[model samples]
Target: MSDRDTRHKASMEKLKARVEEKIASANEQRGLIIVNTGNGKGKTTAAWGTVTRALGYGYKVGVVQFIKGLWECGERNRLEEDANLELAIMATGFTWDTQNRQADTDACQEVWKEAERMLADPETYLVVLDEITYMLKFGYLDIETVKQALENRPLEQTVIITGRNAHRELVAMADTVTEMQEVRHAFNNGLQARRGIDF
Candidate 1:
């Protein structure tokens, strides 16, 4: 082999050894709190991907949508077809569209109740709180209350919270946090959101 190729192969072997060592040392099997947040798109999309993965393992999944209500979502439509999944789209619409603070707060509280129920259930393996940061950011849901629910959930019930500007407390509590940065988007050029791609 060439000198460059020999060096590359040795580096990859060392990296593989490190990865395998870490995997072997990780013995814990508890559920994780995963957060997907940023200004870019795909936070909800990533959470739904996890939902699909959990469902493939025969896990019972629950989804509660906080800021997107009554809108047509292709992921929701597809996920709902699975018998193992249960979804609740709770918001009337975005805060700007609803223009009713009291109504929005009331709706969020009701949706949170459903989320809490799923969190407490041991049978529910995964719970997706889609766009939940908006409710927390708007002060419609108490952060402490939400934190407590997540903290006290079943040992194997994983929770995914998705939205932009996730609160500091939630970020601190998350076991896995992913921030999607937007470099460029098609909408910036006045291109409207496409049906399947954007929604």
Candidate 2:
């Protein structure tokens, strides 16, 4: 082999050994609290990806959409058809569109009741709280109540929270936190949101 090729093979072998060692050492099996946040797109999309992945393993999933009301979402439509998945779209509309603070708060409370029931259930392996940060930021739901529900969930039930500007407490409590930084977006150039891509 060429000298450059030999060096590359050696480097890859070393990296592979390190990765295998780490994987072997990771023996713990428990639910994780994963957070996807930041001023960027794809937060809910990424969470849905995880939901589908878990479904592939025959896991039961529950989804609660906080601020996206009863809109037509492709993922929602597909996942709701699965016998193992339960979806709840609990919002009148976006906060700006609703313009009714009391009504929004009431709706959020009802959503939380459903979410808490899912959290308490051991059969549900994954729960996705899409756009929940908006509710927390707007004081529509109590942070302490949310935290308690999360902390008290079944040991093997994972939860995913997605939205921009996730609360600091939620960040600190998360097992894995991914921030989607916005480098560029089509919307900035005045392109309308595409059906399958944007939603």
Candidate 3:
């Protein structure tokens, strides 16, 4: 082999050995708390990907839309057809748009009940709390309440929390935290959000 190809093969072989070692050392398996947060987009979209993955395996899945209100969601439209999925969307579109603190808080609490149910369901393999960080950010949902619920969830049931500005406590406890940084968006360039692509 050429010198360049020989060096690349050795480097890849070393990387494979390291990865196999780490995989072998991970003996125990348990539920995970995955946080998707940042100012960028795709937070909910990534969680939806996980939702579909779980459903494809015939596992029961639950979703609670803490901030997403009455709107056309293409992902939701497709996922709704599955019998293993349970979705509860909030009534208020956006707290900023509604400008009603009491009403928004009320809706948050109501939907939180559904989230609590999903968290407590042992049969549910995965639960997606989409856009829930907003409720926590707005102080509509208590951080302690969420923390306690997460702490008490089934040992083998994973949960995904997606939205910007995830609380420190949530970040601390999460097994995986993905922050989507906004580099540049087309909306900033005077282009409207496309239906299938943006949503």
Candidate 4:
């Protein structure tokens, strides 16, 4: 065998040998904050998948959608009916679309307060801050408040933040950071969002 092949084989053997010993000594890892950031679709959808999976495990999930107002995200419609989830929506729509900066900030603060409540609630195992980057982007909400809320959230609670351009500090603090790179998009071809696919 080549020297590189022999070295790779030896490394694999070492890794295999250590796995059993590590598993025997491992303790339950603490709950974490997961951030999904990028300029692509599916960030919120991916988080919704996590929300559903966590619900299946009987976890109490809280969802606070920051920029998207009362619009229908089918997941929210369905999940809100389930007793395992708490859903809060920022009924003021997007900043540019809404055309009222002060009103948008007020709406953001209202939803943010609810998010803060969920962060404090020990019963909530997972909290999804959907599209919250827009809140920070528009200055509707302070980023430090959001950061402190996440940092000091009930140690048992896992928070998931999803959006494009998540703050650098927030990404640094998150236990897991997933950045979805957009290679191709149907939107480029003038395709609009479809129900059950985009909301």
Candidate 5:
């Protein structure tokens, strides 16, 4: 073949390779389940970081705070105003704060049901189940229901479950599990949780 013809053939091959790369990248979907467990301060923070990242990408995000009520989460307050996000926090406060086991359980059941809807909805691209492990630990939420939600969530949606003492089964099922180990905490030294930093 002439030199010109050889050059044209090489260009065609390059174009074909580029088209294949585009197709492969487009076909790839994001399906991730991250569990932030262990004793640390940043579990929910890290999960919210992911939510912020997803929101920056124009994806719909749902945040479900299991035990924490509508009191104040700086991140939640900020994201709640965004039209693309939905915030559902159990406004009944902590179980101990409420001092009623049955009531707390009922409240968890109610909020968790709402969270379930977000998990199942394909339109929701990111679902953050914040402090859900506390619900499980308190027996307010069923582990199996949480497990099933993870299993049945939209294949392209990203899910985050953040709390201490994440169940082994949930950890096993998660695509990424981060265990935050607490070496030394200021709270142990009599420092209260600081605003914007801890809240």
Candidate 6:
């Protein structure tokens, strides 16, 4: 064999051994708290991907949407067709459009009732709290209450929260956190959002 071929074989062997060791070390299995947040896009999209995975596995999945029901969301339409998924949308429109703090707070409280129920449900393998951090950001929902619900939830049930500005408490509690940073976006260039792609 050539010298390059021998070196490549050695590199592959080393990588294979490292991967096996890491996999062997990872034995504990528990539900995760995943947070997707940042000023960029794709937070809710990532959470929806996870929800789709849970639903595909025949596991019950729950979704509670806030501050985003006004859009013509193709994802919501697709998710509704799944038998294992329970989707609730708070069509309260945007906060700036509503211009009523009290009304927004009332809407949040009503939707939160469903979220709390989903979190407590043992059969729900995954719950997506879409744009929930907006509630905490606007003080529509209390942080302590959310933290307690997450802590006291079913042991094997995972939760995903997606929004722009996640609270400090939520960040601290998350098992996995991903922040999307925008380098460039088409909309920023004065282009309108596309139907299925942007939504």
Q: State the C-alpha lDDT per candidate.
A: 0.92, 0.92, 0.93, 0.89, 0.88, 0.91
Clashing pairs in 6: none
* Model 3: lDDT of residue 165: 93
Task: Assess every candidate by TM-score.
Answer: 0.97, 0.97, 0.98, 0.87, 0.83, 0.96
Give the alpha carbon lDDT tens digit for every residue of 52-73 in model 4: 9999999999999877757778
Q: Per-residue error at 28 for model 5, in Å?
A: 6.1
Judging by lDDT, tell me the better candidate of 2 and 3.
3
Global CA lDDT computed for model 5: 0.88
Poorly placed runs, candidate 4 (over 4 Å): 1-28
Segments in model 2 whose C-alpha atoms lie over 4 Å from true places: none
Cα lDDT, model 3, residue 84: 98
lDDT of 3 at 6: 100
RMSD (Cα, Å) for all candidates, in order, is 0.9, 1.0, 0.8, 3.2, 7.7, 1.1
User: lDDT tens digits, residues 115-145, model 1?
Assistant: 9999999999999999999999999999999
Q: Which is the better candidate, 3 or 5, if ranked by lDDT?
A: 3
User: Residue 47 CA error for candidate 1 (Å)?
Assistant: 0.7
lDDT for 192 in candidate 5 is 92
Tens-place lDDT digits, model 5, residues 105-199: 88888888889999999999999999899898888878888888888989888899998899888889888999999999999999998998888
What range of 10 consecutive residues in model 2 has the weakest lDDT sum?
69-78
lDDT of 2 by residue, 50-130 (tens): 999999899999999988857668887777889999887776868888899999999999988999999999999999999
> Model 3, 77-134: lDDT tens per residue?
9989999999999999878789999999999999999999999999999999988898
lDDT of 5 at 189: 100
Predicted candidate 5, C-alpha RMSD? 7.7
Best by TM-score: 3
